[model samples]
Target: MTTDRAMRDTDRMERPAPPAPEPLPRPVLDSHVHLDIVGSDGAGASPEAQVEAARAVGVDRLVQVGIDVESSRWGITVAEKNPAVVATVALHPNDGPRLADLDAALAEISAMAEHERCRGIGETGLDFFRTTGPAELAAQERSFRAHIAIAKRVGKPLVIHDRDAHADVLRVLDDEGAPETVVLHCFSGDADFAAECVRRGYVLSFAGTVTFKNAVGLREAARLTPLTQLLVETDAPFLTPTPHRGAPNASYLIPLTMRALAEVKEVPLADLCDAISATGDRVFGPWP
Candidate 1:
């Protein structure tokens, strides 16, 4: 008979989250994560348990991001009940082509944006890697522009998910006039892309992928970014950091990424944590 951890492993969840790392010297937010997905994926922790675990490690806040209408609604509800969580609402670009009524779907997303617990609009923008053909790509562009409008109208930050489509993402933002605040969630751009984002003053949120030994470009991007323009996330249950890459990830594992980032930027660990903490408050506003 298999042990419980082994049994859960057979179900395809990433492995159980690693032991809690030492707490950070200063608190900072996991700028993006999918707590609902973590719970559903047999991550061996409830949402409340995840939050408590994160808090115990100095990750005092989180921004639960939604990729579709259902997940968006769940994020908002989670935020409402958890003081440590704030929600970001959006329809994932790849999900754009599947919607029977794109406009109606967007309308619901827009309405959700009005909730006080919802602090950002995104995990949106574009994904050229997964999308092919004009019709599907067109749907993503339309949804991206619409999400930008919602973010601007609500005066909240626009969280972008740019994957292999840096140029198009910037063009659309330029054409639509980006919201007052914008973030590139799990920023996957190169040094040149990082320069442009820096010039435009958008925050760059790095994930655990930065800790991968072969992620030279990502580490370089981190080095180029100023502390003020930087944020950290696990994008957990997904991009678990090195030494724990194959394991399930949670906010409690943030210190591992934080330390990696500090090394890349050549800054003291405590100082970098403080800067990221302050930037979190700046971009997402005070958590309620």
Candidate 2:
């Protein structure tokens, strides 16, 4: 099924999340994930289970990303209740076009963004692949620009969701001027695009996709990125890492992605964890 459909499809949730892999040498943070989505999906893992399971396997910190008003509020509630979790609020590019009153919705997003538990503004940016019409694309851009402005005003990291629209994403960021801390979550770019982002000092957060054998370019991007600008995630209930590719994904499985990243970066796992932890602090501020 298409990712757009899957994100909205609760009925066809994948099988339960897989068993956890061996713990990492040191702890690291999941830079982006959807615990709300995971809880609804087949995994049916509670927030407590998801956080503790990841912590057990050295993924102690979690960032629950929001894609709409309802989810954004849910993320704030989740973050308030879980010390291990922080949240980011935004209108997903796909959802932006579907909103009835986008401005009113954004106003709520802006208000939620100021909460102490909310660490950033995004999972925003552009997506050309799913958006076929000019009107939808225009709405996405309008929402993206508004999200960027909100992030800047709030002085929070802008966690971006860029898919198949790298150049335009960069164009808009350049036009609006980016926040001090910008994260390309679930980064889906080639080495060249990665290089451009790196030059601008944006954090490139990788998901389980980098573990795919066919993701040669993504691996190269990982290799090219300095550890200080790098982050990892499961984007759980979606990009399940290798060895457990078909099953549902959760924060507990971060080691699979972290291990793959360590191999690609050719660094000791402990060293990688150290770098990720430091960068996580820089990007999200230490989790409450």
Candidate 3:
């Protein structure tokens, strides 16, 4: 994807801006976000402003993830600046080929993992949904393996992003001795897949798509999965939840997503929030 020019302007602006409203009072953790994308959206909100908005909405913490090496580094930098934001560094599947030197890339990621603010080792996995070609598939697999190896070596949870490559992803995770904590970020699979993942002790993180009126399949997956294995995410700047659909998303919208999850699970909203928040803390480690 092309870089957003608006983000560059925000980075250059010299004056400090006003603070955002405190996050909402819910016990939620936004497991995925793209702060650079959100900040670049031409909205008045800066990255810091977004965090404040999330706080105002009751989100306790957020995990900002990167899609490429540059963004991975930026994710760490942003996390370092915000007490409520933790970072995950990995080359997203779509950007897998960008890592020309796999070993060096892993080394850089390893260094980032040393930070207290860095919580996990991914946003990495297979994506057969987009490009297709023997060469591209091979490249994606290579990158995915490299990321898994890094997570194994560093002993950090593996945050997976599987899109239209569920079978292959499950196979790889099984082969790789799947990390102790495996989070399927923005899980878009069916109930069977959800059951399999839960059986394997993987966590299924739901995004705003769960709130869509026609998202029967996702809702089923959400309900079928055990609450202890469930988590919620914004995947912000993308997958904005219903009501807020078609607009830019942020961590602040996490409760709406959680409320939807509560509806699917047929539990009270407070119970759902408590379970997800506790699960997130256990998986991601303490909020920095």
Candidate 4:
């Protein structure tokens, strides 16, 4: 898959700016976001401003997810300074082949996992879509296993990035004995797949993509996810929700996606917000 940053760059020229939605009835945390990349959208605010904007709209907390070693360290730094942010570290599956030493990269990620602000090990998992070559796929799998071990060893939640490889992701997790806490970040699956994830007790994190008009399958998955296993995120700088599909995304835009999710689950907006907030605390531990 194309990098989130690249997509955002293209989107900047093609789409109109998104108007902010009404603030949520209660606070909800964005379980996965790229605050670093989101800041690059020329029209976007600084990371500090982004955080403040999110807070003003009832998005009081966020999980800053890293896609590589440099970004992982940056995420930790951001988390250290922001009480509302927690970090998750890992090399993205799509980045495996580009790394000169996957083991060394994993080692750094492991060390980062021990940080107090780093509450999860993730953005790691299979991506059959982008990695079609056998060697690249092998490297991706190796990196994934290493991340799983690190998460289990450190006793932190394991955040997964399953993109067009849901079955393989589950197979690998089952083979390696998944960490106690597993989250399917930006969950991309159908109702049946959602059942599989639910059976394994993995949390399903919905992003702006779920609100797209063509995301019927995603909507089904959202509806199928239990209240306790549900989480919401912006996946900022990418996958901006409908009415803002082509615009640059940020944590502040989460209320639009959350409202869309509430509609899909047929739950009251305030109740869904409460559930998502509580689930965030449960999945990643209480926000510090």
CA lDDT of every candidate: 0.86, 0.88, 0.78, 0.86
What is the C-alpha lDDT profile of model 1 across 1-288, one tens digit per residue? 001111234333634547778889988889998887664433345778888888988899999998889989999998889899999999988888878999999999999999999999998998887677999999999999999999999999999988889999999999999998999989888888999999999999999999999999999999999999999998876677898887777788899999999999999999998999999999996986
Instruction: Please give the distance, in angstroms, between residue 279's alpha carbon in candidate 4 and its true position after superposition.
Output: 0.7
lDDT of 3: 0.78
Cα lDDT tens digits, model 3, 1-288, are 112223233332322322333333457888888877764342245778777777776887888887767888998888878788888998777766545676677668778866777789888888877666887788788888878887877788899988888899998887777878899999989988898998899999999999999889889999899989999997866677777566666777787887778878999888888888899889886875
True lDDT of residue 177, candidate 2: 96
True-structure lDDT of candidate 2: 0.88
In terms of lDDT, the best-performing candidate is: 2
Q: Give model 1 RMSD, 1 decimal.
A: 4.5
lDDT of 4: 0.86
Clashes per model (N, Cα, C within 3 A): 0, 0, 11, 0
Q: Can you write out model 4's per-residue Cα lDDT over 57-77, one digit (the tens) per residue?
A: 899999999999999999999
Q: In candidate 2, what are the lDDT values of residues 1-288, reduced to their tens digit?
A: 015533554533545557779999898999888887674443346788788888888998999999889889999998999999999998899888998999999999999999999999988989888887999999999999999999999999999988888999999999999989999999889999999999999999999999998999999999999989999998877888898777778888899999999999999999999999999988997876
